[model samples]
Target: MQNKYVNKVLKFLKWGAFILIILIAYTIISARITGADPSFMGYQFKNVLSGSMEPTFRTGSVIQIKLTEKEGTEYEPGDIITFQRDGILITHRIIEKIIHGDAVTYRTKGDNNDGPDIDAIPAGAVLGQYTGITIPWIGYPLGFASSKLGALILFLIPGVIFLVFGVHYLRGWRLSRG
Candidate 1:
């Protein structure tokens, strides 16, 4: 009787883990061939949380970013780009780029923003351009989970439930053998 549920759950876990592993491997291989590595540190997500780039990108968009800047190519004005600012990820358009010998300065602004950004963004601040975004509402959960409360709910609750389920599953296996 209990063996049936145990078998079902174990089988499900096996297949689920197998599929997840295969998908992850495939993603890694695809990234390598495409000249990118698509994983984040500590399983992070760099998402576009605001409507700063409208008519093209909306709020609740997941933008996969690549670290490590490419050199020798000067990004020009009107090129969309993403960059790290104070450790946070930001994506905006380059409205101006001034090349002074070895130094490069940039001015960036959001498309939907009223005016250009108040500050002049140096070339060092730019990361990369807007590559892609997931579906609108579908990415909301992801963006939300990156937040404080949502992180707790998304990670802690599921972790606790999985632990409880694992214990119950092992207990059932032991009881069945007795």
Candidate 2:
């Protein structure tokens, strides 16, 4: 009975470790292939930092955005978009659209804010439109994956775990041979 229980636990641990390694590999490969460019593949992921869009998407939410091209794309009222302002990315709803000759501008406001934004955003500065996919509270861990500590957590910890397991298995093999 004791040996049977030990075998089951070992099998479970082996499968769990295998899944963890695959997950880590996939994450790193996808991020590298995407090159951290928001415009790449017309899709990007961002972490919600504020309660500006509260009730719609709370803070610490992860949102996937699809980039909108300047041509053949019409800005509509009530559309959520991510744009760059003073080197920061802001996500808000478009309340109005203003056209000047060949150029277009957008009036945006946070869903939780009382008034529209002070300045209109030009079409050139727009990043992407929200695809309405929000995963709650995942942004915190994803945020960590972009930092030095994140690298340690994602790579080092797993590597260490695998190494310890390998050493233990080798020791068992040697004991069985002797």
Residue by residue across 1-178, what tens digits does model 1's lDDT show?
Answer: 9999999999999779757756755665676689753565412235667888885677766665444355413688887777767766677888888788888877888999999877776777766555454456656787575467975675567567667978998999999999
The whole-model lDDT of each prediction reads 0.69, 0.86
TM-score of 1: 0.63
> Please, what are the lDDT tens digits per residue for candidate 2 over residues 1-178?
9999999999999998799778658766776798754334677788999999999999999999988776524768889999999989999999999988988899999999999999999988888899999999998998888788896787888788888988999999999999
Instruction: Give model 2's TM-score versus the native structure.
Output: 0.72
Query: Evaluated with TM-score, which candidate comes out highest?
Result: 2
Candidate 2: segments with Cα more than 4 A from true spot: 1-41, 70-73, 162-178
TM-score versus the correct structure, for each prediction: 0.63, 0.72
Cα error of candidate 1 at position 159, Å? 2.4
Cα error of candidate 2 at position 162, Å: 4.2
Tell me model 2's lDDT, rounded to 2 decimals. 0.86
